[model samples]
Structures are given as structure tokens and as C-alpha cells.
Target: MTSAVHYKTAWEDPATRQAWRRTAMFRCAALLGWLLGFPTWLFAVVMTPTWLLVLWLPVLWVGIWYTLLAMVAVTTLRGIRRVLRVYPWQVDIAEVRAKKKGSTQFVVPVPERPEKSVSLGYGGLLGTGQHFWVRAMKSGEVTSAWFAGDPRYVGVVATPGPRNLLWVAQREATDSRMSPRKRGVSPEARALARAAGARVGEG
Candidate 1:
């Protein structure tokens, strides 16, 4: 698992309204850019003839405007993707330490949070590195597992010592059969939970 996972700020809190607001802002910005383009271009064209030395200024301005517009569109789309019901996920871990005979203590780590994603593709939009598809409950058992959409391979990170943490991604089609009990909530419910305690119809 890669440590540089790019989680959006909007996803950190379970506020549907806020998420919606952010999405709406993106749309509004997109609209504003579209509406402003024609006028700006027309104005630039009109001004160019008045100043022969600046005849090429409009071309440069349009290039810069389009470039900025594209960037805004990309950022908006990325923000939208981050909050997608099918793409977002949250993973939590719980660790336990027990004392045994001969003054020996054993530590065990258990998953406490939910696992989710935007799509069923292998690796995240960014690389998820190598991961595993744990088949059974046997300790130290490991195997390779492909993401739902993509066929690329990623390494599954697991707990190192006792009471370690490991949260892996799931395949879309096989999530029902592969995920843990509580983690197997319905897609809608999972989306809510993954959003850090968001609930549907709670507007």
C-alpha cells in the first residue's frame, strides 16, 4: 500500500450538504468560465486593432484562458470523483494485547473501520502498490489479488508486529463474497459509513 494516498478534504467529514456545495461550486465555476470566454475573446479581438503592437495579445490571452479553464474542469472532476458513492472508502483497525504464560504478551490487530472505493479498478487513481487477497483466516497466509476494473497488480500491506494495521481494497463484483461481515454493508450504506458517519435522507 502506498502512503501517499490523496484523500480529498471534502471526504474527511460526513456532510452530504458540504459535498454537494463543493460539487455545485465546481459546476458554477465551469459555467462562469464558459460564459466569460466569448465576451473576453470578443473584447480582446476588438482591442487588438487599436494597438498594433498588441495584435498577438489576444492569442496569448485565449491560450492562457483555455489552459486555466481546463485546469478548473480537471480539479472539479477530481473533487467529484473523490466523493463518488462507488469510489470512496474508509478503513479502521483495532489492536489487542493479551498476556500469556511465562510473562509473554501477544498482540492482535483487527479491522475496525470500513473499506470502500470509487470504482472497481485495480490500484487507486493513484497507484495502490502491491496488495493481497487473503483467502482464509490462517495467520501469515498471503496471495495476490487484482482490483475490480483494472488488471494491474498491487502489493497488499499487512501488520508487521503484533497489533499492526492493514486495510486492503475490494473488487466490485466480488465484494459481497470477499469482505468481512460488518464491512459488507450495502453499497449505499457503505458509502455513508465510509464518509465518516454520514447517513442518507439526513439532509
Candidate 2:
């Protein structure tokens, strides 16, 4: 008897939006470093005199390698910390339809974009669909959740918490039981969600 609820994506929240913006910028910088580090080092090597190469080439190579490695390590660690630091966004609970084995399925529309949705898959030992929230991230990425409450007002923790692999496995098991259905919000939807979030700051 639970009807669908219309709610915005977490990105719609102002604080969450700003935090994700910082995260995105950090990631972009990391990616740029990964792409340009080797080429920049190679260029420096090529520009050096042959005599200098004989004396410092190995040192330069080792230094560059370690520098690049450190950049990658720091970027990855910071990204993880950023994600963990951002609090989970509250979801507007939409339709809580029952699936196989008493599991439940729901879709939270990515704010201002009707075309995209964040689908949640819930699974637990109770078979009452009262625990474990799971959602797909980018390809090869995993996300999971823990939830509380019931149909009227349910609370969800969407952060990629500890025990990620375990939650992912539980999600996979729950998904396997689901009928053929699409998962995750689309890229376009995500972009729109970001745009909408940005507008909130502008206003």
C-alpha cells in the first residue's frame, strides 16, 4: 500500500553539492597529473644535455617515478577521505514495491531530471527488505548502504561505508533475484543533477 514518493537526489542538497564539487575538482586534478606526469618527465629528459643525462638521468628517472607515484597515492587517499567526509544525502522515498524473497525496490529521481533515477536494492537475512541499501556507481565501482524506518519515512546512509565488498555481494545477490530492470542513474541525469545543484548556489 506504500505509494511512490517524489524526492530530489542528494546532489540537490546545497552542502552535499559543494562537497561533491570539491571532490570532482580534486579528481580532475588527479586525472590530469596521471595523464601528464610521464610526458612531462620525458620532455624534461629529452631537453637535458647528454653529459647531464650521464650524470643525473638515473636520479631524474627515479625522482620522477617516485613523484608520480606519490601524486597518485595522495590523490587516491584524498579522494577516499573526501567521500567519507561528506555526509550521506537524504532520499525522497518513492514507490517501495516488493520483489522476490520479500525484497523491496525503489527509485529516487535525480533532482530536476525526470529521465534519470537512483535505484536502490535492499536485501537482508530477515527477508523483510529492512536492511542493506545498495546502488551502482560508475563502471567497476561499488556502493552500498544501511537503512532504517519503514514506508512512511525511511532513513538511508548512502555513503560508501566499511565492508563495501560484503555489501556489494549482498546487493548482487539481491539484484540477481530482481526481474530484468535498469540500474543506476544515467550520465545525462547526473550532469543535470549537477547543474541543478549549481543553480542552488547561484540563487
Candidate 3:
């Protein structure tokens, strides 16, 4: 289901080359590889009896180790690709509400479940770390292609357009504390609140 109200962000600007690096994928893979070394060594030691009894067991273990190492290598390669590609993505915060028979219902966008990253190192063949980035966008009318799995949010991507701009806000404080009517409220939320006959001061 889609929300009828369409909102755009004047503040949504393109991301820089550095922003993608902060993504969870890069950090997770680095941690995974560093952490896996110990367990891998333990597994090899525990399987020694089997490796001695059957040559194939040793070979299989070696294969598994190498495969993991290769995964780490692949993850690093992907990270490099991100640095090179450096696409621009639009970030916007939105709230979706679905209408029921007569009343309106607030729809909670699906939350992202944390993922466990597996290290890509196994003994003997260039084992490396592999990190996977889960969905970062959701499918929607304006953002279907970049749409990730969580239907609650939508992030649109744009090519590196000719123009690059940054918007910054500076508030002039009359007093340290904002009046109850002048606190933190998003423009979109304020608009919605006003339309529903509610004041737009504090959320």
C-alpha cells in the first residue's frame, strides 16, 4: 500500500565519497575477519584426529578455510568498488500511514534486523574477509529501483549530477529553551499536524 501524501526534501543532498565508507558493511567485514582467526585455528586443531584417519577430511577442512579467506578478499574488493563508483544517494525521513475502513492507521516500517558478518579466511589459500551490506533502500514509487527490503523507508539515488550543493542550518536562539511551541518538529510532521487540526509546536 502507498501513502497519498508525497513529500520531498529540500535538504536531501547527494552523499560524498566518504559517506559510503561509514556504511555497516565495511565495518562489519573488518571486525569479522579480525575475529575469525581464533576460531578457525581451534577448528583445525580439533579436527586433527579425523584429518589423520582420513586424508579427505584434512582436504575438506583446508577447502573450507581457503573459501573463507577468499570471502574476505571479495569483501575488500567490493569496498574498493564502492570507493570508485561513489554514487549519490538521497536521504529522507518519512512516516507512512495506511488508511483503514474509515480511520487512518499509522504503519510502522519494518525495522532492520542486525546481521552477523562471517569472516573470509581459511587456512592455505588467501582467505580474506567478506562483509555483506543488507538492504539500504525500500521499494516505492519514487525509489523502487533503489528500494531496499524494509518497506517502511524509501531512499532514492541519483547519478553524480553536475551540481553538488550542501545545505546547512544555523539557528539564532532568543532564549536557551525553545518555547513549547517552537521545539523540534520536522516540516513534514508540522504540516501533517496542522492539517489534522493540531498545533505544530512540539511533537
Candidate 4:
């Protein structure tokens, strides 16, 4: 079910960009990478069997972090380049697929192909990380999609905030490893599955 109230986002402007830069750099890009990458590396090394089996695990582990850092650099540079160029803000209606403490996920209007638009999988927040860890909550803000035009700023969240909310937010990709069968397209099916799983666990 979709929320009846729609949120309007702030327009991309100087203040909005400032807010975005601080959040992106300190919270997500540089700091977050180092914090997560180091711990992950340590965990892998400490784990007894997993690393031993994957013999070259140490080399691979360092390489993984290097790759992540490189990606962070490239993405930052690209976004900077995009910001330099002017693009029309394409504000379109998006379905509030998932809502979490700090982030919101939604499907943007595929103007060219309406059929390709996301109308499923948002039945509930099961896979959306609603209760999971997210930094956006600390600031009482969310990043929907940055540099992609203020899509109503954030189609999913209609909360009152900066008019340029989109300037600071980017739609972080979601985990889609689960099979379609497990995703459960409709809400009722998902509910039933959860109930069954609960009953099984009780046994």
C-alpha cells in the first residue's frame, strides 16, 4: 500500500549542495569506507577456517578494500563532474517502496517505458533495511537521489525539510540476491510466508 501523502523536495541549490557534501564525505564516502573496510578485513583474518581455505585471502582482502576506495574516488569525481554541468530537474512521481530510519527507496517514473517501472517488491519493508543501521537517521534526513533532479526531492518521503533535499541524497542500491520466488510479489504472500517461518521456528 502507498502512502496517501506525497512529499515535495527542496530544489538543488548552494545550501543543499553544502549539506550533501558534508554528509557524503564524512558519513558515506571516505570515513565510512575506512571504518567498515578495516573491520571487515580484520574479521576475515581472525576467522579460522574461512581464510585458511581461501589461501590467498589476505591478498584478496586488501585488494577488495583498494578496489572499494578506488570506486569511492571515481564515483566522487563523476558526481563532481555531473554537478558542474546543468541538467533540468526531472521531477517525477515515484512509489515509496521502502522506508527506513535514515534512507528511503522508491521507483522513479520510467517516462520512456512505464511498464519497466517498479510496481512490485515494495509490498512491505522486509528487504528494505527499515530497522537496520543507517546514518541518515542521525541527521533526521535522507538521501533519495542526488544530481538526478529534485524528484519531488524524494518521492517516497514527503517530510518537511530542505527544498533541495535531492541535492544531498542518492538512492543507494538495494540487495537483490534473493530469488524471485522468495521475494513474494504481493503483500499477502509475504505475510503468509512470515507466519509460516515463525511457526516453523517455534517447533
Name the top TM-score candidate. Answer: 4
Q: Which candidate is the best by lDDT?
A: 2
What stretches of model 1 exceed 4 Å from their correct place? 1-17, 47-83, 91-203
Evaluate all candidate structures by whole-model CA lDDT and list the values in order: 0.32, 0.37, 0.30, 0.36
lDDT of 1 by residue, 4-105 (tens): 123333234344335345546755675567667767766767777666537656665655655564454444343243333332222222121222221211
| Candidate 2 stretches greater than 4 Å from native | 1-7, 44-203
Estimate, for each residue in 75-168, the C-alpha lDDT of model 2 and write its tens digit. Answer: 4433333222322333323434444565545545444354565555454223223233322322213332332111111223333322221111
RMSD of candidate 1 to the true fold?
Answer: 16.9
- Model 4 per-residue lDDT at 21: 59
TM-score of each: 0.29, 0.28, 0.24, 0.33
How would you order the candidates by TM-score, starting with the best? Answer: 4, 1, 2, 3
- Lowest lDDT sum, 10 consecutive residues, model 4, at 194-203
Candidate 3 regions exceeding 4 Å error are 1-19, 23-39, 42-48, 51-87, 90-203
lDDT per residue (tens digit) for residues 28-123 in model 3: 664576557557656776877754646545656765665565455444434332212322222332222222222212122223322321111111
Clashes of each: 17, 2, 16, 7
- Pitting candidate 3 against candidate 4, the one with the higher TM-score is 4
Q: Quote the positional error of residue 109 for candidate 2 in Å.
A: 18
